[model samples]
Target: MRVTPPFAPVTDHDLAVLAEQLGRPARGVIGIAARCVCGNPTVVATAPRLADGSPFPTFYYLTHPAATAAMSRLEATHVMAELADELAADPELQAGHLRAHHAYLADRARYGDVPEIAGISAGGMPTRVKCLHALAGHALAGGPGVNPIGDAALARGDWSPQRCACARPGPMLDAAGVAE
Candidate 1:
């Protein structure tokens, strides 16, 4: 499968903001996958392999603090179990999730083919819902219809991409989370 460019090139300023968001320098970043209303990175596209030569399976990584918190809250409420049950019971959702798994693999394949992590998509895709953060990240990055589980998580979350919940607006910020 071929994955088109729905993302922008990563820049130094983006790296700095990502460091602030992730609490570490971003690694194997392909581009900013999704952004907040104010342009802060919400999801990032990463390479299949990391700088340290580790096999990385997650393609769409969610970094927005508020969004991650929201997903965490949802997970704490046992929403992942409910989603997994739903995925098991609903045939359409099951099929869609399988396609989503394939799509995710295709997207990741565009970066590189890592033999160690091959046939594995993140967040327990095509089988179960393990991580809402990963699912929501993929949903946000690929847009509405790609991942049904991701869309469901995004729908259930309290956070909104339509609003700006970013730390700073324009340019890179300081360590204190203020615009520099």
Candidate 2:
């Protein structure tokens, strides 16, 4: 597997883009974990604890609206249950998930340790497939092969990371609640 370098520092322009995309100010963001083909942030690496001291165990958070919507659709189809069954039957998948759990912990440790969330990874990792968003986020951050379940989910989704789906010349959403 290929190794990704530590996250780079967040920039003002990145913050502006993130704020525009999220429709709110980004909080506890340590760095951009992954970017879309259009150069927009798809995932962000968040601090273990938020500014208000809430323990946030999801170190990698999915941010792109298109990507988030895709994951939601996958979850709605009961894909998580199917993936959970696969995890239970496949020893190789189980081992990969365990490694992913460890990697996630190591990445979060760089920010700070929160006793409340120690040894816990997001999306029911290392055992079950609870949240596709978190799994996709981890896959995007770590790249392919790092999160096999995530990779499979992404492959099954309608969206493609290689393409830019953002509404051109403006924001993804408009005032009329339309997708641009």
Candidate 3:
């Protein structure tokens, strides 16, 4: 799955389920061990929050670097799907809107993968094979284009805008209510 925001959270329940999935005891504590199957020793963490300053009754965020890195692309796809399933069942989530996230969810369904967490969703584009032309085009150009300024810059900064020869403040807030 494409690395999107909210890299799944690390709740107690998720660890429990993950342990069970790995054939470990359902009640034993499961911390990030050595290298992830993907060969990286990074584990990811997310924090699902509530209105109060304290964390919600749900989960925490932590990552085992090696483990997450070790995950194959296919394995990650399956894991993302499992996360979507759990998110689908969440009372806090708006289930109806989730249908639009099929690109991501379908991958999970296809691979029959389950997430360590029991209550989170994933969002990503579909992983269909690209046409040779598309690949060639991408190669001729660079890879996917990125917004030079990330979401953080857009949310809280007065970044310099791109323009023609003359430097000027570009327009803000498009008709569609997005940074154009």
- True-structure Cα RMSD, model 1: 4.8
Candidate 3 TM-score over all chains jointly: 0.17
Q: What global local distance difference test value does model 3 have? A: 0.26
Q: List, residue by residue over 55-103, the lDDT tens digit for candidate 1.
A: 9999999999999999999999998999999999999999989888998
Q: Is candidate 1 or candidate 3 better by lDDT?
A: 1
Candidate 3 stretches with Cα past 4 Å from truth are: 1-65, 71-77, 92-180
Q: Can you write out model 2's per-residue Cα lDDT over 76-175, one digit (the tens) per residue?
A: 9998889899999999999998888778888888789999999999889878889999999999999888888888889989988888876532334233
Provide the lowest-lDDT 10-residue window in model 1: 170-179
Ranking the candidates on lDDT from highest down gives 1, 2, 3
Report, for every candidate in turn, its global Cα lDDT versus the true structure: 0.86, 0.83, 0.26
The backbone clash count of each candidate, in order, is: 0, 0, 20
> Higher-TM-score candidate among 1 and 3?
1
Per-residue alpha-carbon lDDT of candidate 3 for residues 61-152, written as tens digits (9 for 90 to 100): 11331122323332334543443454456533333223323322332233233354223333221122212111111111111221111111
